[model samples]
Target: MSLPYTTWKIGEVEHKLRLTTRQAVAVEEKLGVNLLKVFMPRQDEDFPLPPLKVMLVVIHGALQKFEHGVTLDDVYDMHDDYVDAGGDQTSLLTDVIIPLFENSGFMPRQKETTDDQATLTTVK
Candidate 1:
């Protein structure tokens, strides 16, 4: 069966970045963390967000399908460059990666909570 894919844009071209079931499972096994939870953290979770290295590893794993000829070493180098270039890793995940994953139905839509909604409380 075909795996779902997210869209990643390079320059003017949009590429389909897909993660197979095996790939996803392997990432979780190797990293011992769930990418989705890290990608979208909840206020109630006990653990802190996964480390930056872990997140990069997950990103490299997910990009394997579309980024042929690119080794993990290369991805790591690029990741460093990305950070050095004032790129925020969280922004990459939220702005670039999450949108792609959402488009492919790999992740559900995250509800946007506003200040008013967050402030709602019970007085009883």
Candidate 2:
């Protein structure tokens, strides 16, 4: 079966990011951290941001399926150019990382509810 993936544009090139079971295992082994925990939600205000190296490694792993011959250095360079073009970490998180995992079936997609639905829930 084909794994789900999402597309991210760095500069003029569009790269496909996918996280297969094998690739996810590889990434976890390389980082020595369970990806499920790494991607977990936290409530603490002081919760630490994911390390830059971890982000790069995940990005590299995701890129391996479609971006043959790509390396960690290449991902770093793309990230540098992305920052130079005014992309920030927040944007990267929302645009690339979140969607990458969500679309890859690693994270659950948040459901949207209307005001009436919210009111019904509150009134229950």
Candidate 3:
């Protein structure tokens, strides 16, 4: 099976972002909050987008797995490069960040049912 990862391009470099269990724990420690909780807001509060630092931390965490010795500063620079290349923060969040978590299995995936399975009749 293919490994779970999200591809992010900054300038000429393509980064594979994957959050393994260890990386996820490290990210949570750095953020001082549960990784999942970062995306979840209090029931009484409106859902707020994560701060830039949180995004960078997550990106760095995912990147460090494959790109050894990579630093958070490198991630910041990558973000700048991405923006300079016409990638906006909104698109980055929607396209990269969200997909990263989804691909990492932190978020529930949509179950795909084939036509044969979809046509199954229930027995009483």
Candidate 4:
């Protein structure tokens, strides 16, 4: 199932988001496949450590975006996957994943707290 918009909350803060105009057009052009990330510029990552942690955060954020929500158990499951894969648990989530999402038009809502998750009702 897919939601046009997905509301993500952090503590008392909430983020209401939908695909941006550009993103919408891109999605339409792709015919429904999520724009995937193939390469990352952060080659400086501690290969033996950082990539795994970063991958976890990316997965977590992806679940939130696509699934519209996720529970602690979900995070735990991801964390387990990381551990099982022999990844380091000390990597920085923001440093690892946020840049890519931001560059791709996925961003946290400006207000960070609003029960409003609506897609672009009208494309620009």
**Quick one: best TM-score, which candidate?**
3
Off by over 4 Å in 1: 1-4, 7-16, 39-49, 109-124
Clashing pairs in 4: 14-112, 14-113
Clashing pairs in 3: none
On residues 30-63, what C-alpha lDDT tens digit does candidate 3 reach at each position?
Answer: 8899887777767777955778889889999999
How well does model 4 score by local distance difference test?
0.44
Worst 10 residues of 2 by lDDT: 39-48
Candidate 1 structure quality by residue, lDDT tens digits, 1-124: 3336665444444545666677678777887766566655568866455567776666677777777666678667766666676667666666656665564456775667767776774322
Candidate no. 3 TM-score: 0.80
TM-score of 2: 0.77
lDDT of each: 0.64, 0.81, 0.84, 0.44
lDDT tens readout by residue for model 2, 5-104 = 7777767778899887888899999998888677555787364467777887988999988886798999999889888878877677778888888877
lDDT of 1 at 14: 52
TM-score of each: 0.59, 0.77, 0.80, 0.29
Deviation of model 1 at 56, angstroms: 1.1
Q: Is candidate 1 or candidate 3 better by TM-score?
A: 3
Better of 2 and 3 by lDDT: 3
Order of the predicted models by TM-score, top scorer first: 3, 2, 1, 4
Per-model tally of clashing residue pairs: 0, 0, 0, 2
User: Candidate 2: where are CA atoms >4 Å away?
Assistant: 1-3, 40-48, 111-124
